[model samples]
Target: MRAIAPQPLLDLANVSKMFGGVSALSDVSIRIPEGRIVGVIGPNGAGKTTLFNVVTGAFRASSGAVTFADEPITHWPSYRIARAGIARTFQNIRLFASMTVFEHLLVAQPHQGAGIRRFLPARRADPEAWRRAEEALAFFGLAAYRDRIAASLPYGIQRKVEMARALTARPRLLLLDEPVAGMNHDEAAELRTLLRQLQDRGLTILSIEHDMAFVMTLCEMLYVLDFGVLIAEGSPAEIRSNPVVIDAYLGSEA
Candidate 1:
């Protein structure tokens, strides 16, 4: 018998997003198979973040559809999409100013049927939330910084905290934007290992990254976008040599 292919955890079918007269994503279609690490690469203004926004329901698509876990979620609200087991970290680290690493994880636990109250910090989180938060803390090796204010930590540490917080939500699909943006060589390498570990745990990840070295080595496959359009996609070896990709985005980097 022929081997079966994995189902996509997230699928974007000819999705497009428009703002007034400008188009941010133009008929972009991509599929993230279950338990894989996929990366999207493009230069600045390539609409990478816009893609994330549309998928996460920060912005509704002008046309086309998005499916997650076999459910149509193109029109779902941001919170609803999140509650449905999709979580994300921003390109810019968004950590609470006065909250510790552990506190950040506690507050990030997904809660349903709680609207505005969810935004308010909990005086005492439930035992399950504490367990998840603690697991994330240990997974990311952040136990030492658990009591330190998240924002007071170094930039790389803060990035880890953001990821840890996202994980505490217990997402099936995780979207990471510029995950290694400000990290040093060692920090990025360590993150690469951690991400692989997450994938081993059956998490599907879609990330937008400019760090070519990091993306090339870490992702199972890559998609290249230019001016809101997907230009190319393949294994790292294929992308590195594609003329269109090199000319359009990778340039000297490839």
Candidate 2:
């Protein structure tokens, strides 16, 4: 008997991106199933962030297809892609300079409907947005910092606030770029637990991380990219032992 595979929540088919004449991504294909945590690891200049940009419609791929939730979004604009149940955090934390942590979350909920209304400020009277904001705040253990200006918070807490802001959108697919870039051990571990909880609740996550230990322990599958090419992919144990991965990216870390 043959077991059927679950349809992928997100699929990138032979995707490539070009910057003028330079190639940023070259015929890369990957698929992520729903409710799973996947990691992409590579050294600096490996096109990891570029890959993220393409997925989020920050850049249009020169070729290939990006299908999410069974729909092809290859030519969609960034805002349209985001409104279609995908949300992401940048490699560098992006927070509203003068907004409080709670306010940041409140402003991040997905705007419904079309027209000039979408560009207007979020409705302060919307209870559902407020509820989601509070839920994200509590889930991220950010209650104490709720009233503080988001940009003025400590580095680690700012990270939490950014993640919380993303969650308020209630995205089905969450893309994290170097999510644990500046955290201490305990903070990173706490994030691992939090992400697992989100996964258990059926949220799909894809992250690009240089923190090998964090990625190794947290991701169920890993993809290795080097010089804009996907060089390897496998389970954590297999990736650790893969000679090409060690030579190209992991080095002594492997």
Candidate 3:
């Protein structure tokens, strides 16, 4: 008998989004399988960020369905979507400058309560939460910097801090928007290793990146978009040689 394919961890089915009269995403569909790194690439103004926004509920789609782990989340609020096991990092680092690295992770812990209960002082530090934070710090090589203020860290470390904060949420799927942006080759290389480790630990990652080399080398599959439309989808090798993808974004170098 032929084998059946497993359902994707995240599925976008014929999704489209419009801003005023302008279409930001037009009939785009993609699937991210469990335990794999999937990449989305496009030129500037190609709606890559908009696609992320729609998936995370920053904006509602004009048409189509989004399902995560078999649950429909297309119309869910941003916070609701986040609480439903999705976590994301921004294209630009969004760390709390005045907060220490440890504190950032603490705030990301889910189900701490609400209203006055939320404000109730912890009688003592939650040992489990702190342990998780420490593990994340060590994993990202930021344990020594845990007590340091986020703004004081080097740019690459700040990016790691943001990623660490997201991991503290214990998300089922992580969305990274340009996670390697503004990094030197050495920094990017270091991050590449960290990402691979995360995947090995069973985290499902879907990322948007302009760093073609990084995306090509790291992602198992690639999706290319242009002017809000998906133009191509393939393995990295196929993407690297696709004439349409090259003309639209990769240029002659690809």
Best of the candidates, TM-score: 2
Q: Which ten residues in a row have the lowest lDDT in candidate 2?
A: 116-125
The TM-score between candidate 3 and the true structure equals: 0.92
After superposition, candidate 1 runs with Cα above 4 Å error? 1-6, 113-125, 252-254
In candidate 3, the residue pairs with backbone N, CA or C atoms under 3 Å apart (3 or more residues apart, or in different chains) clash, namely: none
> How does each model score on TM-score?
0.91, 0.92, 0.92
lDDT, candidate 3, 1-254, per-residue tens: 63498889999999999999999999999999999999999998899999999999999999999999989999999888888889999998888877999889877875544545445442234556767877888877888898899878888788888898988888889999998889899888987887888899899999999898899889999999999999999999999889899898889444
Candidate rank order under lDDT: 1, 2, 3
lDDT of 1 by residue, 52-88 (tens): 9999999999999999998999999998999899999
What is candidate 1's local distance difference test score? 0.90
| TM-score between model 1 and native | 0.91
Q: Is candidate 1 or candidate 2 better by TM-score?
A: 2
Cα-based lDDT at residue 83, candidate 3 = 82
Among all windows of 10 consecutive residues in model 1, the one with the lowest summed lDDT is: 117-126
Candidate 2 global CA lDDT score: 0.90
